[model samples]
Target: MPELLNSRVETCFQQAEAFFNRPFKRAQVSLKLRGQKAGVAHLHENLLRFNPQLYRENREDFLKQTVAHEVAHLVAHQLFGDSIAPHGEEWQLIMRGVYELPPLRCHNYAVKRRSVTRYIYRCPCDGSDFAFSAQRHGLVHQGRRYLCRRCRHTLVFSGETRVE
Candidate 1:
């Protein structure tokens, strides 16, 4: 990561902790330069993704605001569970009281959205297809290779495929 990008990621985590009045011990922050339409708060796998282009274009103001936005979601879920409304009154209060951000509003950026691609694999002998979350897919020998249970054939990881 570039210096600016690393700084932004660290700053976002720091701001989030300060705003929540509680430190997030195990949370991880990451940047995705092209996944804006995927939303700002992706909580699965304990990761948060911020659009680098959006942060760069807006600089400090946008960085602080979005960090608050995503942190609100994380805090809310940790407290009240994931079924709660993402941007409801509880979230709004956290944004204000904890983060000291202005009143919440639906904010959108005009950046061009890019499609995410996933990798696909197949078993050469049995013709079983396997889909993976990452673009670069490979199989390691130390671990048990995902075999076609039905055909007992070794799986081969293929290449990336555009989903969009």
Candidate 2:
């Protein structure tokens, strides 16, 4: 079924073929590339990445639009060159004119949100409190200090907050 998505990309590549009247290589779909984003296209690498989480949640759109979206980026890069702006006229043309898909800048998939534990910290200067993500909290627990940009004072961990 993954290959089915690649076939969709090949269909999009063929559209680029007719549009530019030149050869366009097919883009491959990668499930291993994880990100908060729904998809990404590496024009130089000839690769397309779909967030596996997004893929699982919205397989229909993932197949229908995500492949075409990323393929349009590659086709736009081939026609317009690296200096061209991403999601500019060239990409939009391939997206809308060629693929017949909406020239949307991003997707609206419902990705799963993980519960995060935040550490609350305060600066002594003004008694202002700030929340730190788990990664930042780990750094603080490792004896790293974060300074307040406004007060120029080291922020100390005051408490913890769980975000769901």
RMSD of each candidate relative to the true structure: 8.0, 3.0
Please name the candidate that would achieve the greatest TM-score relative to the true structure: 2
Q: State the lDDT of candidate 1 residue by residue for 1-164, as single tens digits.
A: 44664564565556667765677644566676364532366555666676667777776666566666776776666656777787887777777776778645655666765665666668887666777655234334345466777777766767546475
- Record all residue pairs in model 1 with backbone atoms less than 3 Å apart, i.e. clashing: none
Q: Kindly list the per-residue Cα lDDT of model 2 for residues 51-118, writing each as its tens digit.
A: 87787788888888888888888888877799988989888888888878888888887766767777
Worst 10 residues of 2 by lDDT: 26-35
Native-to-model Cα distance after best TM-score fit, residue 2 in candidate 2, in Å: 1.8
